[model samples]
Target: MTLLDFDSDRLAEFATQVRGDYEELKAKNLKLDLTRGKPSSEQLDVGEALLALPGEGDHKDADGADVRNYGNLKGIRDIRELWADVLGINPEYLVAGDASSLNIMFDLVSWSYAFGNNDSERAWKDEEKVRWICPVPGYDRHFTISEHFGFEMVSVPMLDDGPDLAAIRELVQDPQVKGMWAVPTFGNPTGITFSEEVCRELASMETAAPDFRIVWDNAYAVHTLTDEFPPIHDVVAFAEEAGNPNRFWAMSSTSKITLAGAGVSFFNSSKANLDWYLATAGVRGIGPNKVNQLAHARYFGDAEGVRAVMRKHAGSLAPKFTRVQEIMRERLGEYEVARWTEPEGGYFISLDVIDGTASRVVELAKEAGIALTGAGSSFPLKDDPNNRNIRLAPSLPPVEELEVAMDGVATCVLLAAVEKLGA
Candidate 1:
């Protein structure tokens, strides 16, 4: 059969059998991992200069602020400008800080519970029970922070259109609901960006709680796996116009940009939110790692620097991502038995196995020396109500190994799908 067999039943069947053979082979091969959305070692090379850091060459900001001091707690000056440009928010609204943006998120929640923002005089902990809406197939760490704080967690459904807005609107009308975890760009696990309508609606929303906030985490703003990634600026501005300009607390970091652990994080919001965060966080420490923040600013002076670095990352990642999709299309595409996301920019592609077979597929992968992120990790408390979604993080594996490993995954999914259908 020709290579471009769009309708070649023979090629299709052959692909299916190849999957079975690979799974059989995997049952005998050495160990491997294709679960975490971590950048490969080769991918890490682009930001190597960041590791050496503020060498003797560079030393100050645009305003003569020293890079080696402890008082720039809000963040380094130029990088604040850089973060503003990078995150598409005003520089005044941004808080340049320590490396982990997620850490900042955790801290914000802690602050809200322990000490309410300036607008609200009461600590959230004094309330009967605070609540948070967690979009399903969401970041586990987001859910953990809520659970850690003893906040009631509500699981909101997510589809291609983003978190079901109708449910979100209704849920937020309750005064007890405090915030929602959002990754508007290239959302983790499911490469879903919110639809423009949903975003605008979220911004225009009148919540039940005056102190409510949107934990707007835009972690994968530039990592596009497909051409479908749209810049959702329309919806992002709702917080400002909705009268509660501080409604969205946005955070991003260069951790995934330059290096995972050592990169700097930017926190953006309205004037009120910034004043609130700074007032509480001001008591805790000096400034963030300005040295690293400045290093990133120097390494990537503008959008061009960020884009150039991302393109290099995409080059290293594309082949691996493409291979996984190709295998899935070849082996599981025809079955009507399983479905997977065709992601545009995020690190993960969520796979939905036959109704009751996800755990089995993961178990099969595990027995053969591959460790899938535990089956339910994409959900809160590692619980996927349907036990159907599996996240594929293709960036971490080499092409050759990924090809073989993905084939095995396809085989497991197919076997599980077919077995259930037969029963």
Candidate 2:
């Protein structure tokens, strides 16, 4: 039965039992972590072949540019063409970079704030007030970037298919609303891919801000937990067709597919936007690590080779995701005190507990020696109005450790829910 059906007496008894469970959990003194969505060691082993790639004397790119020396600020063609095909963008439009796409994202915003983008009438720093649209239960790092820029972050609901387009359309009516953040494919924690209709609307929608941009962080484009990768829509093409050619700054990476810390990153946009990026990027450094880029190209000979690597990732990851869902159902199903997303791809499972109790759940779990992503971390400024959401990262730990940690988490959830209800 659901907790709501319980009388005061039964509720008290249940709370006592859950308290006992919590005590036993604390007694175990377990040190388990579910805080970050890092790839497991086994998953990393899948890409061990990358370590020895591009053997000696393989420094020249397809264009015969010596990769060891610096010159191509736009990145080597070999890696760009490979990931361009994977991300469904033209090779010319894609710029391959170093390990972290997050760094590239930060640079984009930083440059725009200081010098503005190709279409900006004035640098963002000159604006009286800058604002950004952040979809709720989204990536914390994205919110961190927005917050760091001192932009007034406005939260919009992330629906099943995509961010609420109607709200976005309304928000864009204000010229200060410069852009929005989107993880179009297998989004960070939600695992929801934007539908074609949503993509069309976002690309074509009218905005008062002439320089409106979308940070399309497709981080998990191929990090699927299923057999087939989802179709990646060409949002840039949509924007071009809709007369908003500079609307999107799309990005992806090999971070999750291969080595998380040592992988190539990609950026794709209109020619004007790319030129703008290159102009500033040129001053920032001589060029990206082209030798590393060439190594990646050699690692994944073609697009299919990339998919083959992803299939290995799926093989290792799918079971962990499945086990998390199974444990959640087995433990929390009857209580009906929580619900969570069952994602087909992506590294997180978004868990929502009883209203006003998420923080308590996190606290209880911490006391029991389990670490969870902080309560309300999925929202901007570390705030969740209802205090009801928690992001669960099951990717880091092994299946056995994950199962144990999840069980402890389930106990914590029940204890927190009961305490909240009884009080």
Candidate 3:
């Protein structure tokens, strides 16, 4: 039976017993964590060559621009070319920034509140209280940004395929609704990609707020754990075809590809949007570190180089990811009471348990010394309506320990679900 069927007084009674059992079993396991989506230090080693790239002989680019200099506020030209190619947008349409695309995301949101986009009128904050639609079981960080700024976060149901477009469409007419957060490539926590139809719908929005934007963060564009590298549906192109030049802002970084502390970040959009962002950014700083930009240009010689580096990341990360999958398969995949997303790539596996049990399950895991990303973190303001969504980050643990940690996590999931439903 599915997890829902076990929701009953009798099942809840039995589940309490199961938790009691798990509490006893847990004493045997010492400690582990399946939280936080950072590359294992070992997995991060794949980009070591980036530290010493572009020797003295490689300083000058084909455009006669000294990559080492810092005058270009829009990032080194070659850097834009590289990211533009990687992001699938024309070079002229993109304004590549330095590390931290989310910072760029923040700037855009802040700008919308302060200044309008595309020669539009009225500031976002000055307008009616802003509303944002967030796909539940989403990236917590994205939701946090909105909440910290006081944007009313409305939860749009996230399905196995993507966010429910019908729900999004129904609310687009609400004048207070201003934006949505999207991670198209491989969404954090859930790992679901937006369906082509949904992308088309969002791009073709007829909203009361003309300043509506889609914060497109493709953090895992190339870091797939799956064999096939599925391409994300391009919503920007759809928006243009739908005649909304400023519909979405595309972002990415080499934080994963090259190095985290120092990596190139980028943004892509229509010309009008680029001009607005550049104007706003001119006040923030003169330029991002050019040396890092040059290093990326040299480290990733071309588009093919980006892919090659990603393939290496996949090779290193896959083994770690597999350990969690194998453990889930062994412990819960056949039980029918718990289910997890089997992503082709991306750093997370989203787990859903009996409604209202997620937070409790996390507590159980923690009592035994396993740290999980807080329950409801995948939802807006960390509010999972059903409290069933849990994000599993398996990329950090060593392979052998990851196996045990996942087993412990599954035990907690089953225990929590059973307890909640009296299973």
Assess every candidate by TM-score: 0.91, 0.99, 0.92
Candidate 2 matches the true fold with a TM-score of: 0.99
Best by lDDT: 2
Local distance difference test values of all predictions, in order: 0.79, 0.92, 0.80
Residue by residue across 8-56, what tens digits does model 3's lDDT show? 7657665666677687757776677788888778767877887678766
What local lDDT score does residue 360 receive in model 3, on the 0 to 100 scale? 89
For model 1, the run of ten residues with the poorest summed lDDT: 1-10
Weakest ten-residue segment in model 3 by summed lDDT: 1-10
Give the best candidate by TM-score. Answer: 2
TM-score of predicted model 1?
A: 0.91
Model 2: per-residue Cα lDDT at residue 260: 93
Models ranked on lDDT: 2, 3, 1
Please, what's the RMSD in Å of model 3?
2.7
Tell me model 2's lDDT, rounded to 2 decimals: 0.92
